[model samples]
Target: MSEEDYRIGLIHATVNSVQPILDAFQVHAPQVTLVNFMDESLIFELNETGTVTKNMARRLLNLVEKAVMSGVDGVLLTCSSFTPVVSEISHLFDVPMLSADVSMLEKAVDMGTRIGVIATVEAAGPTTTALLEKIASKRQKDVTFKTVIIPDAFKALQNGDRTKHDKLIHQKVQELANDCDVILFAQFSMARALETLDMTTTPPILTSPEISVKSIVAKISKKEIVI
Candidate 1:
């Protein structure tokens, strides 16, 4: 299929994540069409419960099912907190399905033994760390993780305080620079924080949207739906 013919579905848990991935695609693969499915309630419920409930998983599956039924070539789940659920339900779909952070985490694992994960959501930090460990274990590599959760930053972003949100993440990135081999921002929304940091001065800090977009684009280009 031609690049324009490929349709990738982006499943988001919050409005915060939508734009970053869209920006990434605009920069990296503008020819591919994107279809978005968002459920803001998922994030609210997750924040309240502090975990993924069975109902949440079912909702996520239904969303992906709807995306597939719409004829997307692949599905990208944009929330790190719900990433683990992708592993459980991906086999049910023929198209490739991916959690946004998986590509980033795999790259982090390959780059260093000590990985630092920063997130603005309570659940995202642990979810990212667990996924990192899983990636390392699958590769038979021993890895250590340091996770920092700044719920306040998430609140700040939600309230339209982008300056404060970026500042908080920038501070953590600086703190983790010397301590870790690499730093990873756990949410697609946090990608904006990179603009405020001096990349040359920090450890290889990574974000999900760009890497995930490139991964999905490559897969779709090759017509390979391996997840």
Candidate 2:
């Protein structure tokens, strides 16, 4: 690949919380280009209605494929709960496609036997719990995963109510602090909430950015050739 060919496509639910992750990536791989395709409001809707419309999925796929066609070295999906569709897309592209939460999952598995999944979006809770369970079972260790949702935070973010969103997330995470060994932010957007909450009273809080940044950097250093 040419020096100018390093590019990545980020498919995100919202652009708000993704800035730090991208900034970290920029420092590690300055040559890499980022193509951001954001819905900005879908996560909130999914939280409110408990559904992701087919049309929304279609729109996301279209933009994702566009990024692939635009010559991205790899794709990093930023929405944790949407990995079902991301898995299909990765198969279709037959390239490097990393899930947003793979890093956090790996860390949680290595850290302790009990994991807590905290997602501000209601629809994400059950789905994220299953992911943690699957990862734990693969390691031949029976682990327990507890999921808790912050009521209405997603909706509040959608409505531009940052204070309400932050408060609810802080409260819910604190409530779940006593139950698990490690806290995994199930949604990429929840990173901020994790920071807002008091970490002194809880287990270690893990975010996708730390893991994804490392994962992407490794991929870059290995310099895998796709074509």
Candidate 3:
């Protein structure tokens, strides 16, 4: 039951998120083998319509089923916009299934009442804000979540202008950090820039990839589960 033998599946909305997830695993769980499933079009499709269709939810479940069939020990979903889909399907599989932003979202709410969720896509904002609201309601906590969507940064990253993308995110993070009690980067892709970010100006910024990876690793290791 060595970590090297464990296989974890990562499903991404776009290719941009994979590198950051991989980079995070390299630090936190280097031995866990990764099987990545990327559907870059999913993010674009969701953003265009600003809602998750029935077919889209089915596709998300299908992808997770596909990953389980591939012999993964656990699955970590790296798309924030698919938050609702994840909730429907997580319990469908015996293996641990984690929604990308839940841990960060919970932690943000725990930190304070005023939460700033920064997303580079429109679709991500609604789903994540809704999630935080649900959690807040469950805990009977009065919380206000403000979402800031910056699709320009997302476009820059898609076009290979990472410097522009990171700069754009950093500027927004600084601004959000000043306004809110805690900042949660809403997309998995945004986690890539976390390391290089100068955090002097931001409040405690939380990203999903690292926390998700760590949670998945804990699940697989604790259960020594296999598909």
Candidate 4:
């Protein structure tokens, strides 16, 4: 297939996730076409319930089904909280389906024994840590984690306070820098905090958007849509 023929679908649970991945694709694989599907209600429900309910899982799966039916070459779910559902139902689709943080977590496992996970949402902390542990176990690597959840930062972002959000995340990153082998921003939206960080003085920091975009692009290029 030609470069322009690659039509990837991005399934998002929040508006904040949209631009970071779009920016990533613009930098890394501009030739690929992107289709976005946003359902902000998923985040609202997750925040209210503090967990991924069955209804939430079903809704996410339905979105993926719609994306596949629309003829996308691959589907990338941008919400880290729904990652487990993606793992469970990815095989149902012929196209490659991925959780945004999987690629980043896989890389984190490879990079360090101590991984730091920073998240703006309460639920994302546990979800990301669990996924990281699972990835490390699969790779037979012993790993420990330090996870910090800043719900206030997410609230700030939702209220359109980008400076406060970035500042909060940046502070956490600095605190975790010396303690962990690598630090991971747990959400696509959190990737924006990278702009305020000086990465040279810190442990390697990994974010989902850029790394996930690269992973999907590679899979599409090789015609390997393996989950």
Candidate 5:
């Protein structure tokens, strides 16, 4: 791809879930370009309590604002729990700013009301559950969210234990199959776990990559020419 072919800028706090999304995005939309960067401080803040802090949002905004200022066509944040800041950033920027969670949650709601949100971080599970419930109410769909936090899954990923992380996530998703109407992966970095695990027993699973990229593509195409 040439410099002129690349156009979209993706802002991520971490790279875990961004890998597969990039692969899929390239295959799904070959003409668009994606750029990723990390705010090292947000990783520490998220891991400290498995949640975002005031400082984390500040650091994230600094990176995302710069991406917008650089003349990118659109911005998609890969972090799920940072929706508060994501909402604020989307409004502040002229270009489309999207949340990885909101895009995927819309898809999940369309599938069913009894949804299971699985996340690597402790906070992501509840945060996503709340967001889905809100979306469901706004759409007037009767919905309930079942949240499961995969214990040690984030630690395994953080510790570089890919195999263990995959195993734990698979087990958690499997257990949820008995309860939820659909399974939704909450963290962006956990996308690899979906391909690694056998989700035959669980309901349909939704990830951030395709949903978010597609939404941003639609939002940008109307406002600017695609490279």
Candidate 6:
């Protein structure tokens, strides 16, 4: 299919995560028209509230509804912390929908039993950890999961210091490298740190952007008219 034929709706909880996903699309699906839906405040609110409340969930659904109504070929919920809502209300949309962390989680389980998840946002920790466990269970893979949040990292990115954010995540992933069979970067934005790592020494690092983009493309190609 020509890249021009694919239209994607990228739903994001933070603007910081958008560029990484876009960069992935450029390399993997450049012909696709990428329409982005972002709310930088959503992550702050979720962090403040400690969970996705009923109202917050409604907001997420409304966002996806907007994307569906916009006639996207597929929707990628690039925010790991918000995937549960997308997963829950997926039936509402006739189009294909995906959680950013899911494809990576499936790959992680297939790669090894002990998975280490590194997330920058506290709220994302529980959401991603649960996702990894769920996928592992369904695959009948005996997986042991551990999540470590770079408490200061997401805030740094939100505050406009990308260097600090990436440095903290890269450091933490390296610290956890020897402890687990494989290290998974929990949030979609963390894929940025992959370029800085030495894969020869660290455990295999799994990220969401490229893999998630591939999943969306495959689903849309099969269904032919998710929008």
Tell me how many clashing residue pairs each candidate has.
0, 0, 0, 0, 3, 1
Q: Write the per-residue lDDT of candidate 6 for residues 92-199, one digit (tens) a residue.
A: 888889988788888899999889999888888988888888887787778898789987988787788878888998888778887899998888778887876667
Of the candidates numbered 1 and 5, which has the greater TM-score value?
1
The global C-alpha lDDT for each of the candidates, from Candidate 1 onward, is 0.92, 0.74, 0.86, 0.90, 0.78, 0.86
Better structure of 3 and 5 per lDDT: 3
Reference-based lDDT, residue 192, model 5: 82
In model 2, the Cα lDDT at residue 64 comes to 80
Instruction: Please provide TM-scores, in order, for all candidate models, with all chains considered together.
Output: 0.96, 0.85, 0.93, 0.95, 0.91, 0.94
Ranking by TM-score: 1, 4, 6, 3, 5, 2
Tens-place lDDT per residue, model 2, 1-227, is 65356677788877655775686576666666787777767666665678667866787788788878887777788887676666666667744778788777878999988888878767677877877778788888888877788757766876778788879877767777888888888877767665567678888888887688668656654656433
lDDT by residue for model 5 over 15-63, one digit each (tens)? 6756866876876776787777677557657767766777777788888
Clashing pairs in 2: none
Weakest 10 consecutive residues, lDDT, candidate 3? 218-227
Full-model lDDT, candidate 3: 0.86
| lDDT over C-alpha atoms for residue 210 of model 5 | 73
Q: Compared with the true structure, what per-residue lDDT tens digits does model 1 show for residues 7-125?
A: 99999999999999999999998988999998999999999999999999999999999999999999999999999998899999988888888899999999999999999999999
Order of candidates by lDDT, top first? 1, 4, 3, 6, 5, 2
Of the two candidates 3 and 4, the one with more favorable TM-score, higher being better, is 4
Q: Pick by lDDT: which candidate is best?
A: 1
RMSD of each: 1.7, 2.7, 2.0, 1.7, 2.7, 1.8
As a TM-score, model 5 comes out at: 0.91
Off by over 4 Å in 2: 1-5, 26-31, 40-45, 48-56, 220-227
